[model samples]
Structure formats: structure tokens, C-alpha cells
Target: MTDLLTIRGVSKRFPGVQVLTGVDFDLRPGEVHALMGENGAGKSTLMKILAGLQPADEGQILHRGEEIALRSPLDARERGILLIHQELSLSPELSAAENIYLGAWPTNGIGLLRKSELNRRAGEALKALGCDVGPKTRIGGLSIARKQMVEIARIHAFKANVVILDEPTASLTDAERDQLFATIRDLKARGVGIIYISHKMDEIFTITDRITVLRDGVVQGTLATGETDADRVTQMMIGRKLDAFFSRAEEKFGAEVLRVEGLGRRGDYHDVSFRVRQGEVLGLYGLIGAGRSEVVETLFGIRRPDRGKLWWQGRETAFPSPRQAIDMGLCLAPENRKEQGLVLGLGGRDNIALPSLRVFSTFGVMRHAREQAVYLTYRDLLQIKTTGPATALRTLSGGNQQKFVLAKWLCRKPKLLVLDEPTRGIDVGSKAAIHALIAKLAEDGLAVIVISSEMPEVLGVSHRILTMADGRLTGEFSGAAMTEENLIRAVAHHAA
Candidate 1:
């Protein structure tokens, strides 16, 4: 019953922030421990310390009754501990076998690489994790789910005793997640301990044995998963009672804001047609690579349609570029917020003002005061947490980054808004706020389109739901017909 690893009195501090304070954690063999926290609740700090990415200001880590010094990630890995980050760390151009044994490749006595042995070992490791991917397959060519499998296979190959997985299922599909759970169970049977960190309540309750909650850099408490409920866990993390997670307003559809007829983008999506009405939220639901994003991208002029027609307020219109779409009163907050929406090096004020610069400028002269006022308005409205308006966007958490992306498009006062994976990678509290904001935007008469992989989100926020599969619209449902079962059936009905 002895713990495999234990953290005692851990503390970490930055210039203006105390990220962790007297936090303690433990991991036992064959156990999956859940780490729960809000966006800025010091969970990442603790994990980084465990992985030896950064040294704790004051703390001690014990392994099997003996204190240990973890000076670097290499030290931790050598001790049979591995951390799989939310952002995957893999060489995209390398083959699966090469990446599996990246720094520790097999070699012959003459110092030449042993390709056959390497591939055989990699294939065995992948098979142990129940993955079917070929060892010679390129890492970049694999899907996110397959890439995750490869990551797990690497851990198995390394014989890691303790594995730290951060948001492991963030981008995975339902089937892929089930596969991952099977792999986790296999690891558990093999006596490996897992440290799981995620914002999803369902996942935590389903997979974890014990739950530890952190708030404001301190440990609130730890409880056995079977003995505690989600309500208690949420209260512990946020120190407040959360209102209903999903807040949907009354449905009141207005005149059609956009109508697409037979929209096709050759290899991406084809024959996609839908209509969005003012003061209504249209939810697009599908599996990954289901052409949902492509449809919205075409509408926002990010992709040109090979054959189709778009009608804007009853007038046939064609937007050759995103700028043209913006000029025509349409804006898209893309799925990859960091890569496609915000400039990480820029400050919050600058990012929110980027899309609406013309509104604050006159005669090609910049208006600092006006821009600041607009930025402050959105900063307050979106409840963006930052030390100052000038703080770099990269310094903010994932949730706040998403809020900034929303503020950028909201500031434009566009007639139609397209939000793709708007709540991906955000915490529960932030998700509720964003959901409420989406409802409010629709209430205020802005046509909205939300493309999300989360079924609950799509069902809760949309007045209507459209299902896509294999680059085409498979089905549409609304009102009482939009259950999860029906949505899944619709997506699978057109499967190739």
C-alpha cells in the first residue's frame, strides 16, 4: 500500500504570482489519480515540477521511501517517470519507429542503425497498446488519436512506471477515447501509476480512482472518486456554486442571414448547404475530419468553393478572401485560436483591436484612446483575466486565450459570427461563461454558427443542429429530435 511517488509541501512562485503553496500529491502503483483545477489553479505548476521541467521553490519528492532530486526531464525519465504534454512533442517528419526510439535508437556493434530491430520493437510496443499503426508510417500522416496511441506506445516501450497524461482525450473521438481507456486499464494491470489532468468531469469520474482538487495554488482537498460527486468537486475547484453548466435562451429565429446552395470544395467538402437566421444559433456537429470546419471556412472565405452559391441577405455574394468576408459583415473565430486567431507575442488590447482597427482609425491615423476604450469594454465584458491590457497573449491560460479570440470578433459588431471549436481546451467555469455569452449574442440578434466536437455543447447551445460526414451534410435535427443517439446515427449513416 506504499505510494510509488509522493510530493510534500511543494511551492512555486513567479514575480507577481504564487503559483503553488504547500501542495501535496501522491501516486500509487496501478492507480489513476485525477488532478482537478480551474484555469489558473497551479495544476500545471505541480505537474511541471513532477516532470522536472522546473524546480519547485520549496518542496521534496519521495520515491519508494527515499527522497530524490529531479533536476531535469531526463532525470525523471531515467527514473521511469514520463510526462505526455497537452501539446504533443514528436518529430512530424520521422517514422513511428524512429520517433518511438528517438534518442535511444538501437544500433549494431559498428555504430550503424539497426532498422529491422527498431521496427520490430516499435511494432511490438504499438501492438501492446492495441494500436494497429504500422511502424514505418510517418508521424505527420497519422490522425490525432493515432498520434496519441504512438505516444502511449513510446511510454510502454520506455517501461515508464509513472505516466503523467495532461488532457489526453482533449481532441479524441468517442471510439478513440474508449480505446485509450482500454490501454490505460492494460497499463494498470501491468502495475503502472497514472497521473491524469483534465477539465472534463465525466472523464475524471469514469477513469480516476481518487480526485485531488487545487484552488489558488493550494490544495483544497482530496477525495475518493466513488465517494464524491461532480457538484462537490466543482465547488472545491472554484469555491462557488456553479449555475447550470449549459444556459440556452429561448429560440426566436429571424430573417435568414446566410444561405449556401450546393457549396463544394473539391477534396475538402462537397454539396454542403445550410441556412442561418438572425438571432439564431446553428450548431454543426461531426467527427474529426468530417468537413464541418471546411464548410464554415468556405463560408468565411478562407476556402474557395469549387462549385456553389452563397446568398447574403437575399443577394448572391462571393467573397474571394477573409478580408472580403469581414467587409461584408461576416467574421470567423477559427478553431486553432493560437495559430489562426491570436498573435501570441501581441498584448490583449492589440489582439482584440486587430480585427476592428478601422473603427478606431480615421484618415489613416491611429486613435489610441478610442482603441483603448474599445479594448477595455471587451476586456470587462468577456471577463478576460490578465495582469494588464499590455500583458502578452501567450501568458494567459487556454480559456482566457479563447475569450480574447471571441472578443476580437465581437468587437467588430459583425452581422454573422462563425465560432469553430470555441470551447476546446478550456476549463468548466470558462465554458459556462462562454456558453452564456453565445446565447446572449444570439439574443442580441447576431447570426451565429458553432462547430464543435462535444455533443453536449452542440445540443445545448444550438437552436438547430446539422450533422456532417465524409465531406457532406448527412442530416439535420432540431427541437425534440436532437438527441445524442440520433446525432451519432446521422453521422454514421453515411459512413464509407
Candidate 2:
């Protein structure tokens, strides 16, 4: 069979890095080919070359056995090649139908907009993808999963020949992911070629026909999906066996670090009671909109509880603001790291110092040497890969960016840490590293709380697990009680 798209000997070079060295990849009609790698393994560089976001230093690209030059995104789109980025790109103020047909809206004889026809066509497109999001609904009002559905709907409407999906299910729930897989199968039936990039082993094995691994800016190897397993693929990507992707040290619990009794926030959560002890890692598991984040935000003083009491170090207290909570030795790594945790426009050193300026500043003057030393210390500790301390945070990979967020808070040396979805959108190696880091923090007698949607993650790093549903603490499990079956049942206990 003829290849739909072929990349031969592709190489890309930045100022001080050879991102891709003689990389070769291909996609065929009616196939889902997976691209797997650790963060900074040259996956994004290669994808950008394919999407015409950047030019390859050395390579040959062929479409239908004919050589081609893709100099811009428009050029790639002209050839029916579309890329759906992990970060959504849609106008929040516009309706779903308008965003779907932004560049090519339906028109009448005089080029006036045909609003009804546009909505109808967009609705049909969304229906084809098994999404029921209202066509006229504003994009800003939709959930992340629904916005993703709208992105996929645009591609379906365009009838793209070759589609590149980057971390497509990073924010989706199980049900939404099933709907996406159905859409993919439908696209395959129509002979659309797909290049799927994800860190999830199950997702890769489930949907991909072939797997290609990239490591240190070079092609490791490609294997037929049916002929290999995750262990082999992970080994290829990281050059080592991850015998235990998650681990925790044996540590004795100390005094209770925090205690919440009958916490309630109007229209958010109510009667949420939990406690975390020193040298303990508590895992909070819940589906989206289950009010997990809301509960944590309240603890960190981002939200005030209308009812209930909080006790820190056995003393009942109230934090009226985040600064007060921080002063009291509490820190939170928010769920949306990109928007809330770190400033992408700043350099790594500046971001790491943003929250702990007092530690680096003396008598109202910035202490550059102390700040630089701290940045280097945490950079080595977290294994943050970057060109220099001055490198923009935005240029770093998702894993490294997340690590910086951790470094920022860890520098504060807080007594308790709240991590919301700590490993979202990062590679497997980074996930394991972060999990180990969490365990290490707990070993040092710091109370840690991890909020995650991934079941395996919640089960692995957490010493004790708490489940939430519809803003209520449904169940708590420890030791023998911590099983997937019980956790699943608890998460749905109060679902409406």
C-alpha cells in the first residue's frame, strides 16, 4: 500500500541542540501510528516539522509518493494535514459553531453570514464525532473535554486526510475518551491517517497500529503494536527498565499536620472532613466537577469555607487569604500549572524565585547570587532540563515546566504541600520521578496531598486514599481497603 505521508532522514537543529538526528517516520492510510518518547526526546520538534510550524534542517517529506515542501501551517492545511495541539486554540468568546468555521464560514450571495446553515453544519459535524455540545454555546463556558470535542469536530468537518493528535486525552474523562476513540475509528474507516502522541501505555496499545520510540533526538526503533509491549517501549524511550513506576519509602507517621472538620463552601462542596499527618501522602481521587479542586483551594485559602473548621498543628484557625496560608507554612501547586503556577514569559530562575522572594531578598534589595544558587540547587535536585537559568520557562517541555512549579514551592520549605494533578500531560519517566519526589518529601516529614484523576496514580503514591463525589467526602481507604474496585465505587457514591 502507498504511504499517505513519509518522513525520511529528518534532522532539526537549534542554536545549541541537535533536536532530531536522521529520524525516519511514516503514516499510512487508515492507520493510527503512535509516537512515544520521554519529554525533550525530540517528539515535539519532529511534529512541528510535519505541521510546518518549523522547517527541518535536513529531511525529505513525501505525500503520495511525491516530494513536497511544507513551508507554513497554511501549506500543510492545504494538503489536508491538520495538527490538534495539546493546548487548545479556539476563541473563548465565540460560539462553538463560529469557532469551528472561523476561517471558512458559510455565506450568502453577497458574502453575508448564513448563521442558521452554519449552526446546522457545525451541529452535524459534532454529532458525527458523538459530541452533543450545543453549536451556539460559547467556547469559554465549556469544559476542557468539551472544548477538545469541538477541536476534533473541526477536523471532521474539514475531512482531514492526515491528522496529528498530541496528548489528545490528557484532560478527558473515561467517557469522553471513549467517544474520542469512536471518532478515531470512524475516521479510520474513511481512510484518514492519524499520528497519535501520548504517554499513556494503555491508550497507545489500545488504539495504535504501530509504535515508534524516540530518545535523545534520534529514532530508537519502531514496532508493530501487536508484536511488542509497554515495558519494551518504555525501555527504548528512557534506555532503562522502570521496574517500579511508583514507590514510597517506609516512614513512620508523626503528629497531624492539618485537620478539617465539616468544611463547607456554598455551591462548591460541603461537609468535607479530612486529615493529613506528617510523613504521610494522602491521595484525593474524584471525577471532574466532583469538587476536588474546590476543596483543596479552600484549604490553601484560595476560597473561604462558609461553614466548618480548619485546624493547623492542633490549633483551630482560619486563613482569610493565600498570603496568610503561606505564612502559616501551607503551599498549593494548582491544577493548571501553565496558567496558575508559573509564568511562561519569565526565565526559570525568576519563576522559581517569585514565590520565595523574601528568602532571596534582603532589606528590600534582590540578592542575585543567593537566588541563582537556589535555582541551580533545585534544578539539579529535580533534574530540570534546560539550556540555562535564563532560558524562558515556555521553551521547556511540559515535564520540566511542571518540575519548575514544584521547585518554586519546595524552595519555600512549607510544612504541608497540596499537589493537584501533579503529573498531568507529562511523560512516564517524569511521572515516576515526581511520584518518587512526593514519597521523598513525605519521608522528610512533610505532609503531602496528591489530587489525581488517574486511578493507578492515586493507588500507587498515596499512603491513604480519600474519594470525593459531588462535593462530598464519600469514602476513605487505607492499606487493605485500597483497591480499584473500592475506589471506583466510592467515587460514584454521591454522583447525581
Scored by CA lDDT, what does every candidate get? 0.88, 0.91
State the displacement of the C-alpha of residue 421, model 1, in Å, after optimal TM-score superposition.
Answer: 1.6
Question: Runs in model 1 with CA error above 4 Å?
Answer: 107-116, 357-368, 494-496
Best by TM-score: 2
Per-residue lDDT tens digits of candidate 1, residues 207-228? 9999999998999999999999
User: What lDDT tens digits, residue by residue, belong to model 2 across residues 1-496?
Assistant: 9999999999998888888999999999999999999999999888888888999999899988899999998788888888888878899999999998877899999999999999999999998888889899999999888898898887877779999999999888898899899889988999999999999999999999999999989999999999999999999999999988997756679999999999999999989899999999999999988899999899888888899988999999875488888878899999889889999999899999998788888997999999999999999999999999889888789999999999998989999999999999999899999999999999999999999999999999999999998899899999989899999899879321
The numbered model that scores best in lDDT is 2
What shift in Å separates residue 104 of candidate 2 from its native position after superposition?
Answer: 3.0
Error of 2 at 164 (Å): 0.7
Question: Which residue runs does candidate 2 get wrong by more than 4 Å?
Answer: 107-112, 494-496
Q: List the residue pairs that clash in candidate 1.
A: none
